[model samples]
Target: MTVDTAVIATRLSETFVAEVTGLTISPEITSEFGRSIYEHYLDHKVLVFRRQDIDAGAFAGFGTIFGRPEEHHVVKLRHPEQPTLTYLSNQDELGRNKEMKTSGQGWHSDYSYKLVPGGATMLHGLEIPVAGGDTLFADAEAAFAALPEARKEFLRTLRVRHQYRWSPDRTDPWARWQYIGPEERKRTPEITHPLVRRHPDTGRESLFIQPRVIGSVIGIAEMAEAESTELIEELVAHITSAPYVYRHSWNPLDVVVWDNRCVLHSATTKDLDEKHVRRLLRLTTHGQPVTPSMPKVGYSRLSSR
Candidate 1:
């Protein structure tokens, strides 16, 4: 529970978000400091470390402290040299497909549809837009805490099914925001995960329903479609409300680490807006991979030769 006074950890707001300063990151960071970072991460679901000078190698190294880095399902955005790194931006990367623009705009926990979702997802800003490209994160842990006792009991009995290539959910206003093309849709069978699950280390229950990914929501005992739709809308509204949210305005070289298990994050226009170019390096750790795990070394992951 102790951190070096030289390094300061300050709460970003009343929410479960914090900012840490006075520490430097490298591929080979001291185990003690990395451990401290992990402890703080568990305490605070979101952490901001500004002015980092880390590269792809160091970013992957930092990620492995919690778990082996998980390659994002949308493989096209991955870095050429680092399999664990995802480059998010409106600008293009060398040798990358021109059509692969910034994606993942909707609110979601990274790899939420997987049986086991990721823990920490780190995003380091390389270039930030002049204005209006901020990331919004909602604290699921807090949201769960604020729910009604009876509703919490009911939520525990629900299951959500996610289909990769399924049709858009008419109930979700932003259903078409993240397009899943035909080839990518059939890569995995439908997955059913708990509507409410506990954070691995913290043991606190948080809602896990991401309607953008979850094609259907039903009670384990079989609920009607209209009931399920109403439940999904009710939950989404409750979780994303302002009291549970923290808006992160980016700075160049800022590294943000958020617990995917307890946070629902949405990328602002900077990640996709054509009018402005925004770029960042993201590393996600510890999740069940549908595809083969990307090797941590040697040749990079390339979708096309």
Candidate 2:
């Protein structure tokens, strides 16, 4: 299919998806362009644009049209001399595989580990594997709204802990917290947050627990663990249910922007040995921290490995 470069927004109503065509914004365009993009992001949750010809510098300049760009916390920052982009390939600078696990494989909001989680994320696909590398996004707001009244009420008063530790069975002990340096880990250890998060700008609640990092629901009794687990799983199921979800098959030059506050996304894996490499540049928006005054909910953070 031919992907056009003109700025066009098309909605995929089947899954509440919106695609914006011809995403390459000229460096000469006024800063208002970025603001317009942000407005669309808030309303649509997902924006897809095509920009095959623009280079990294041009992409960075385009990002500035939305808001101040921040250094990616996990991914290595792009070079100072060329501030326009960062490489997102599996291969390292030496052209060797970094063996970096793709973080987007599971459903998650971008950078929820941080005190200020990412608000939005823009990913430009530089290269794409032929098949099975599409990214899927689920609308958390829609998920929350569809919850049963009892479920919503219960979650509103509960809190969950978020940390960097991986699942005990899946993670190597030595590799525990390996994603973050000691200093960074200390600065931002497991923090408590409401299980249901309210968007400061939109005043809408979203299911905010990070199932991977969250240890347990605070104040829940030990005997109730089975019940708690079942309930949490149900909530996740609701969030990822059909009609509210959309999967985007990647194409070279496709740039997707999504609101981290309201969407949960995952990437499908492709063959590692394939000659073609998949690369993308991601830019994330920052989120405000949840305060104690917001709610009296109990939660527990897993021990630091």
Per-residue C-alpha lDDT of model 2 across residues 158-269, encoded as one tens digit per residue: 7665665534343654233555567866776665666778666555667875345322122222326566666667776777778778989888888787877778887765
Residue 163 alpha-carbon offset, candidate 1, angstroms: 2.1
Scored against the true structure, residue 53 in model 1 reaches a CA lDDT of 83
lDDT by candidate, in order shown: 0.69, 0.62
Residue 42 C-alpha lDDT in model 1: 71
The number of the candidate with the highest TM-score is 1
What TM-score do all the candidates reach, one by one? 0.82, 0.79
Candidate 1 Cα deviation (angstroms), residue 222: 2.2
Q: lDDT of candidate 1?
A: 0.69
Best by lDDT: 1
- Model 2 lDDT-worst window of ten: 296-305
Native-to-model Cα distance after best TM-score fit, residue 90 in candidate 2, in Å: 2.2
Model 1 C-alpha lDDT per residue in residues 1-305, reported as the tens digit of each score: 44555446898867689998777777546355776777677777798988988777887787776667877655676787888888876765643444345345667777665556667788888988778678989888788878889988877777777654343454453443245555565665567777777665555667886554332323222667677767777777788898888999998989898988778888776234666778888888885322211232332222110
- Please report how far candidate 1 places residue 79 from its true position, in Å: 2.4
